[model samples]
Target: MPGFAAHSWSACGYSVQKVYEWLLGSQQRVTWQPFVWNRLSLPKHNFLAWLFGKKRCLTQDRLIKFGVITDGIYYLCGAQQETQAHLFFDCCYSQRCAHLLQHWLGVYWQGDCVYWVIKWRCKSLCKKMIVMAAISGLLYCIWEARNKCKANMVMKRPEAVIEHVQAAIRWRLQRSDFVQQKDSTIAWIRDKRLS
Candidate 1:
């Protein structure tokens, strides 16, 4: 075999896993995976975040590509073409919601909120999970509000969305078992008024 090497051939013969890896090359871990799939997050929130990470959410730009809609204006802001980046990061509505949530959580993220959440440093993993859950909830709510606006339903105000996310986070924390939580983690929950 012209392209084959001795090391490439295993004595036990080829396996599906080996073939898959060879075909796909080395798998690089996504930075947003942990942020999207945090155990403390709700299922819907996790799903929405995963869609966001994959850029699979049906923003108006994608709809235009599909010819389902001719116009691509963002329903939330109505000031620019609707795009994954614009809707999630650049839109004033989303930025305001994110700002309020970040302020409430006493954290500031400059860019790519999901990446920021993954790299955020804190003494407690529990606190980190709480933050991840909150961010996930915020993303989900923003998408919901956008859809509502597109459908001509009453869209929630950014402050209202933040309040809803905060209440959801607090409710989730209340149901979580805290028996083995560290003192710092409990204190964080208390300080955030999530307990």
Candidate 2:
């Protein structure tokens, strides 16, 4: 009873926050958190990005490991195994979509797209938020396209996916009053026709 009392009162008092923290332990910061949870990004997009950052998406490779399916071929390109890395970074189909978005945004970086956004050194926080939202939107759209292909045996063109992401980003930007109303930001939004 003494040992139980000591353990229970270790935090001095029982509160939901303390209990929650105690159960979860120390939080490990991740590089992708800022990009994935940007205020400019949609909630669903953030959720998908979080899953992707965690490598928790049910990619074909994981599905195979789980015995959900035997084949691990990527539905997008059909030339590589569908892994979290392959589906998001290495697959030709996804690469094309990423390249198109990168070109449109005029933001270039090497390695994982999420990390690139995180490390981007733009002076404007607004610009960085826009980029993060767009990138998160791209990841969400790519996964959506993959799901469609899997369910209907049809694949959407990279252009179509890019268009969807652009529209979504544009919509979010238009509705966001938090965007910095600087001349450069305005000009950029006008140039991209995202306003």
Candidate 3:
């Protein structure tokens, strides 16, 4: 063990790696960043991210498998099973949302899966935050819209869904002052300023 030093980077005098080892144990690895739990972060979006990363969100396929839903078909397109892959990536509704996001953020991305798209989308930290905010908001909006469609029999257009995402991310940015954005990026997302 390292001897305690008053100015040690870690309070217990262990290095950052040791802290990670202690927290995650020997087998599991944490995929999301530590900054994800910042005070101003959106709890709903964060929760959705947790479900999404775990592939535990109740997609139609999972519901059917659990005998909660009769059919595994996607409501949006009716052409494929509403598994996590279909709902978040392959279905037309999701693809339309992706296109709208790409246009709004002035970026081009291509991947058959959500994880791949998110992983290789951008290199800049500031841009990464913007993109993550967009993706997170979009996921929340899509899932809500899906539920509403089932309950209220109303399926929103891709444009309407994108508007919902815009509102959500804008509101979230206003609430969080931690992640500052560049002027150009702010202009791109159309947010007046970083809160």
Candidate 4:
């Protein structure tokens, strides 16, 4: 703070605004922010972080530990003790959803860890952002599905959740300015279509 220099402007001469923009433009932010913030809509993005972090008492295991509901193993499949990882990654319903989702996006997501997958580097920023959105959407929709299961409502199937994931990514891409400016962005889409 003592070395602060408002007198010295960025080389582009855009002042502090340029510095802030440059800071945010780094590849590291591209890897992480879309998962925690930016890209996706507000509150949905916020909620995704909370859900993926397993901070809420939504999972069956968490509820059981908290002594809430004692019976259900998992809301979606009712197969295994519901930890966040099991419910979202290992559940049959969710795994089917992920498979269909990968087909829809024309990408196979590697890695068992969500954070690892989210941080997986891509040459195309567009693809990176899309992957981030998919991860977030999958978690959100799964959590929402779990909630519906608890409420005795009609539960969405894996296909339906894949549709939700596609819709969310499509909507985000349609509005993303970065996608328009980045050449690498279009290559993933092009390759996806060709494949």
Error of 4 at 163 (Å): 0.8
Clashing pairs in 2: none
Candidate 4 TM-score to native: 0.69
* Candidate 1: segments with Cα more than 4 A from true spot: 1-26, 178-187, 190-195
Residues forming the 10-long window of minimal summed lDDT in candidate 1: 1-10
Residue pairs clashing in model 4 are none
Model 4 CA lDDT for position 92? 85
Per-residue lDDT for 26 in model 2?
92
Question: What is candidate 4's lDDT per residue for 1-195, written digit by digit as tens?
Answer: 322354345333556666676566654333444466646433585576655664564677777888988875776787778887787778888888777767866668755645765667767656766676676787778888888887886789877787776666666766667677356565454345211
TM-score of each: 0.81, 0.88, 0.75, 0.69
The local distance difference test score of each candidate is: 0.82, 0.85, 0.70, 0.67
Candidate 1 vs 3: which has more lDDT: 1
The residue-by-residue lDDT of candidate 3 on 119-140, one tens digit each, is 6646565566767767777777
Lowest summed lDDT across 10 adjacent residues in model 4 is found at 1-10
Rank the models by TM-score, top first. Answer: 2, 1, 3, 4
Candidate 2 — which residues are off by over 4 angstroms? 1-4, 7-15, 180-183, 193-195
Ranking by lDDT: 2, 1, 3, 4
Model 4 residue-pair collision total: 0
lDDT of 2 by residue, 1-195 (tens): 564375686557657776677668799988888987799899999999999889899998898999999999888888988899998978888889898888888888778888878888989898899889989999999999999999999999988998898888878877788875554864685467321
Task: Please give the lDDT score at residue 176 for candidate 1.
Answer: 73
lDDT of 1 by residue, 169-193 (tens): 7677767774244556555655663
> Pick by lDDT: which candidate is best?
2
